[model samples]
Structures are given as structure tokens and as C-alpha cells.
Target: MSRTAEEIGRTELGPRPLPPLGEQRVASDLSTVDTVLSNGLRVIAVHQPAVPMVELRLKIPFAGTDPMHAARAEVLAATLLTGTDRRDRIAVDTELALVGSDLDATVDPERLSISGNALASGFDTVLDVLADALTGAAHRAEEVNRERDRLVERITVARSQPGTIAREALQRHRYGDHPFTREMPQASDVATVTADEVRALHRASVLPRGSVLVVVGDIDLDRALAQIESAMAGWSAEASAVELPALPEVVGGDLLLVPRPGAVQSQLRMSAQAIPRTDPRYPALQLANLAFGGFFSSRLVENIREAKGYTYHARSSLEFTPSGATLLLDTDTASAVTAGALLEIRYELGRLGLAPPNESEVDTVRQYAIGSLLIATSSQTGLASQLAALAPLGLGVDWLTEHPARLAAVTTEEIAEAALEFFAPARFTGVIVGDADQLSALRGLGGVLMP
Candidate 1:
């Protein structure tokens, strides 16, 4: 007589402990070539033969002190590549479609960035189009007017958003009169931008002397270099790119309250000074941040979201600027729980500093840190974007390859020290935006600056 199927399943398929993870081997065999063009454009090309596509990134330092610069630059980025000397908008779009390529341009207070990807065989076509836009972008009057109107409308909508209001208020409180506050230009300023003003900003700020170009894909190094040189030969500028002044460190003090009438929810934002990636203690700090509030399993999320149901999400991260870095923590919660949430957040910050992570906590976050870094760089597009982000800091492939080792080498003592230094509650200051009636209870919490 054969045994029943249920009897065999219970006897042979009992639960058992899973095996440990095996050793992981990260790929470090990428062949890279670096060159500086005669006109001072630095190019870095990495050979990645797994796929038949090439990723391109171009970064131009576009900083200006003029109050109207941000609005003008915003318009310039929108209209850039709309039309060039050799191709109108339609022809440009048609050619890019033929080569299976799409490019986009964006501007921030730091730089103007262009990123795209194309078929490996169509690399030359991509470079030519890029060169043409750099040299001959027409900034036609009609396109400029249309884009300006659209930009004004978009800005109006964004300003009405809770997130936008919180971010703008934070910047103003943090930087005072610094140029970084120009990140969110006033709608009035954008409405006044003329086509001629955009053209002038482009002529003055789009030079190549301080720019970087990064390409990653399946291609021969020598041939790619030759193609880039030939395609960009006609693009040159006598002036170097503008450089902004260094940012001042954030001053920590009482929290500032921004009134939002009838708001059902409140946005809680906080910031503290942080060290740059180049700092020796950064690896330990990164792991410490993960254990505190930088990941899903962090103490902040476990306490505020899961335990108390104060919010659906809570996160902390480091933002690296050209001159410095800042640690930011943000979450939104119901108005009824805003004061309680802020009190708990302060408690967690103080706890992290007083009683740092234990050995088990440190080990878990260290593994996550290393694993996430390796996973992010496993694809062509991912590697290209990472390289481009690091280029402004003068970092390259070597930095990316060696960072995992650094993360692994961080000790528990170092993490404890980093927590003590950076996670203290007195080291942070920020703004809270909510309805006055809803946040009247916050005044009793102490250290709130009312507007």
C-alpha cells in the first residue's frame, strides 16, 4: 500500500533552518580610459560589454550671483535643443528616434546636467547631436515665450504643494541670503525672463572648461575617444565655467514654525551638519545613520510608524553638496499627533547619541550598506549615474570599487563615536509647517520660534 500524499509531505518536508549566505564577488574588471580635451573638457569612458548600449552624462558648472540667474537658467534648460543651427525641433526628434536615443537637460543651483543613452552603434550620432546643441542652440523667441509661460504655471502649482512649501521654508531658514535659496525662484522672477536673457545666460555659463563628460557601455576605448574628439571639435569657449562660493554651515537653534491655515497634516523637517564622503569617518557615520533612521528597519521607523502609528513613513539621509553635506530627516503625520511625533523623534535622536548601536546592530547595518552599494553598481545605467554624481568631487571608478571595503572595515567603536558626534539632538534645527489651530499644542513643547 502506497503512503498518502499528506503523510509524505508532513514527514519529508518539515521546516528547517536556511543555509547561510555564500561569499559574494563584486566585479572590478571594468576597463576605463580618461582624457582631457584641448578645450578643457574632461572625459571618462568605461568599457561595459554586457549590453549593446552606451550611457552618456555631461555636467556643466552653472552658478551665477545675479538674482535673476535662476529663472533665466530654468528657461534656458527647457529650450535648449529645441532648435539648433543644423536641425529644427522636428528634425532633431526624428534623428534621435532613428538612433534609439532620448536626452534630457536639467538645472539646479549646483550645475546643468544632461543624461541619455543610445545604441552602441549610434554613439557617434549621439555625440554629434550633443555637440550641435552645445554650440548652436537657437533659443528661438516663440519657444522661449511658450516655455516661460509653462514654467510659470508649473511653479505656481508646485508652490501650492505642501512638500514644496516645506522645502522652500527650510532653505530660507537654513541659508538666509545664500545663493542656494535660489533653488526655488519666485514666480514673478520667472515671468520676467526674456528670450534674449536666456541667450545671454547660455553664452556666459555653458562653457566647457570646468565640465565633465562620462560615457559607459560596450565600445572600444580608442574609437570612442576619436569619435568624441571629432564630433566636439567645433564646440569651444574662451571662458571657464562659473564657480559658486562655499556654503556656510547650518546654525542649530530653536525650531521655526511656518503657518499653514486649515492644514490637516503637518510636515516635520530637521537638519544637521554632516561630513563629506571624503572624510575618514564617513563610512562609520553612514552605517550609524542606517541603524538610526536611514533604512526600513531603523529605530525611527520602528518606533514612530510601527509602534505608535504616528506616521506611515519616516526617513533620514545625507545630502552632499559641492562644498559640504547635511543630514536631513523628514516625515508627515496627522495634526493631532504632530507634537507627539516630534517629541518621539527628539527622544530617538538623544537615545542614539547616549546609547549607540550594539555589535549586532552595527553588523546588520554594515552588511546592508555593503550589499546596497554593490547592487546599485551592477548595471550600466547605474554605474554611469554613480560615476557622474561623484565626478564633481573628483572621485572616479577607484573610489566606487574601494568603498565597500571601507564600509566593511568600520568598527563598532567607530560607529559609536560617530553617533555621539553627529546624532545629538542639540546639533539639529529646522521648520515645522502646519495649521495654527492644529499646532497650538506645540508651543508647550518648548524651543519653538513662532512666525
Candidate 2:
């Protein structure tokens, strides 16, 4: 008779240690061609041959000083492709379908972004439709009116959401009167915007001088550049795109409480000033954040979610902009546990600063950081999106290619220093939104800043 399977395995060998990570290798083979058109449109084409599809991203600086600009831009983005001089909405849709393409437009405080994809063979057709909309978007009275009503309805619904309320409250508390606070415009302001105003805003604000276009796919880079140039030649303006003023630096202090009279759950939000990607210490800080709370296995999650069952999720991440960066921490929990969760979160922050990560902790986060970067840029759409996002910051494909090495080079000592500087509990301030009755528990926690 044969020996039992378990007995054979136990006799064969004891438990073995995991193999060490192999030497780092660059996985991306993307080669790019960068060019500028006569009308000042910056075009970047990357050759990625894994798929027969082309991904496109257009970023236009769309900032405005008028308080009503956000509301109007919201409407403009919704109705921009509804109709063009050459094609009504139906015709536009039909043409895009023929090419297996789709395009979407959205505007935020920083830029108006257009992203889409199509078959590599249909790249020219996609570009043609894009150019026509860019130059000849009719902003038809009927389309604008219909979209404006829809926007108001959506805004109304969004305002009723607890998350939206918390975000709006946090932004208001953080920025005060800064234009960035207008991320979601007042429904009343949106209600008053007229179609004519959206048309005029489009005419004045949409220009090519400060815009960037990134195209990625399996195609001849030179031919793609020529096609883009010819297609967008008609889309021009005498003035450069409007650039927003710098965002104010975030200052951290006591937590602010925003009461929601009788809610069952509470939203916890916190943010601290952070270094931009260009900063020399950014890679170390990135690793430090990961070890603290940036991933599922981080200390915050291990403590609050796994150990205490205070929440199902806890995470921290960096939000980058052309002007600056902020590290944000978010979690939601039952109103009863809200105070306890906050206290534990502060404890983790203090622990990270005081004790820092050991060699094993640093190694795990470093591997995760490098691995995530490679995974994010592994596809055509992913690469295109990453490049487009970095373009406004004057970074390019090289930055994407080289960042993994920086993450790998970050030493344990560097991460310790970054943690002591950035992860201190006193470096964060935020708002807590919960039921007023339940928040009595938080009063004893101290450092509560009331509005």
C-alpha cells in the first residue's frame, strides 16, 4: 500500500522560506514621438503594439475667474457633442459607431478633459469627428436646454448624498473662498446659467495654445502625427487656454465636526499637505504612505478593520495637481464607533511617525509601490491616461518609465525620515460628519474645532 499523501509530504520536506525578489527589470517598451502643431497644439504619440486600438486623451486648461464659470462649464461639457456644424447628435453618434469609437467630455477646476478610444484602422475617422466637435460644436439651444435640466436634476440628487455633503463640507473648510471649493456648483447657480452664456464661455475659453493631446496605440507615429495635425488645423484660437491660479496650501489643525442630525453612520475625512511628484522626497513619502495606509495590508487597515472591526475599509492616497499635492485619508464607520475609530487612526499616525517602518515593512511597501506602477502602465489606455495626466505638470513618458527605479532606490532610513515629517498626527486636519447626538462621544477626544 502507498503511504498517505500527508505522511509522504511531511517526510519529503519541511516548510520552506519564500524566494527573494529577482532583479528589477523595466517592463514597458513604449516609444513616443512628441510634436507641436502650428496653432500650438502639443501632440504626443506612443507606439504600443499589444492591441489594435488607439486611445486618445485631450486636456484643455479651462479655468475661469467668474463664480458662474463652473456651472456654465458643467452645462457646456454635457452638451458639447450633442451637435456640431457638420453633424447633428444622431449623425455624430452614427459615425462614431461605424468607427467603433466613443468620446466623453468632462470639466473640473483644472481642465476640460476628453478621452476616447477606437480601432487603430479607424484612428483618422475618430480624429475627424473630434476635430469637428472641437471647432464647430453648435451648443444648440434645444440640446443645451435639455442638458441643463438634466444637470440640475443630477446636482440635486448628488447634494442629497451623505458622501457629497461630507466632501463639500470638507472642501469648504479646507479652502475657504478658494475657487477649488466650487467643485460642485450650487444648484441655484446652475439653474440660472443660460445657453448663450455657455456658448460665449466656449468661444473665449477653449483654445489650443495650452492644450495637450496624447494618443497611444499600434500605429505609425509619424503618420498618426500628420493625421492629427491635418484634422485639428481648423481648431485654433488667438489666445492661449486659460490657466487657473495656484491653489492655496492646505494647513492642518484641529478636526471640524459637521453634524447631520440623526444619521446611523459617520464619515471621517482627513488631509495633510504633501510634496508633489517632482519633489526629491516624493518617492520616499509614497512608500511611507503605502506602509501607513495606502494599501489593503497597511497598518491602518490591519488595525482598524481587521483587529478592531471598526470599519470595513480604511485607505490613504495622494491627490496631485499642477500646483501642489495633498495626502487624503478616508474611512466610514458606525456612529457609535466613530470616536473610537478616530482615536485609533490618530494612534496609527503617531506610531508611524515615532516607530517608523522596519526593514521588512519597507521591503513589502517598496515591492507594492513598484509593482503597482508597472501594472498601471501595462495597457494602452492605462499608459495614455497616465501620460495625459502628467502632461500638464510638464512630465512625460520618461517620468513614467523612470519612477519605478526611484521607488526601488528609497531606503529604510529615507522612509523613516519621510514618515516623521509627513505622518505626524499634528500634520492632519479634517471634518467628521455624523449624527449630533452620537457625536457627544467625540467631545472627550479633544482638539475639536467647531465652525
Candidate 2 — which residues are off by over 4 angstroms?
Answer: 1-24
Candidate 1 residue lDDT tens string, 362-439: 978988988888888888898899999998888889888899889989999999999999988888999999987878
**Model 1 regions lying over 4 Å from their true place:** 1-15
lDDT of each: 0.89, 0.89
Error of 2 at 301 (Å): 0.5
Over the stretch 1-451, how does candidate 2's per-residue lDDT look in tens digits? 8877666556346744456878666655667987788999898899998889999999999988789999999999998888898999999898889989999999998888999999999999999999998898999989988988999999999998889998988888778877777788888888888879988998898889989999999999989998998999999988999888888877889989998888999999999999998999999999999999999999999999999999998999998855889989999999999999999999999999899999999999998888877878888888999999888888889889999989988999999999999988998999998887877878889877644
Steric overlap count per candidate: 0, 0
> After aligning candidate 1 to the native by TM-score, how far in Å is the CA of 189 from where it should be?
1.8
lDDT of 2 at 381: 88
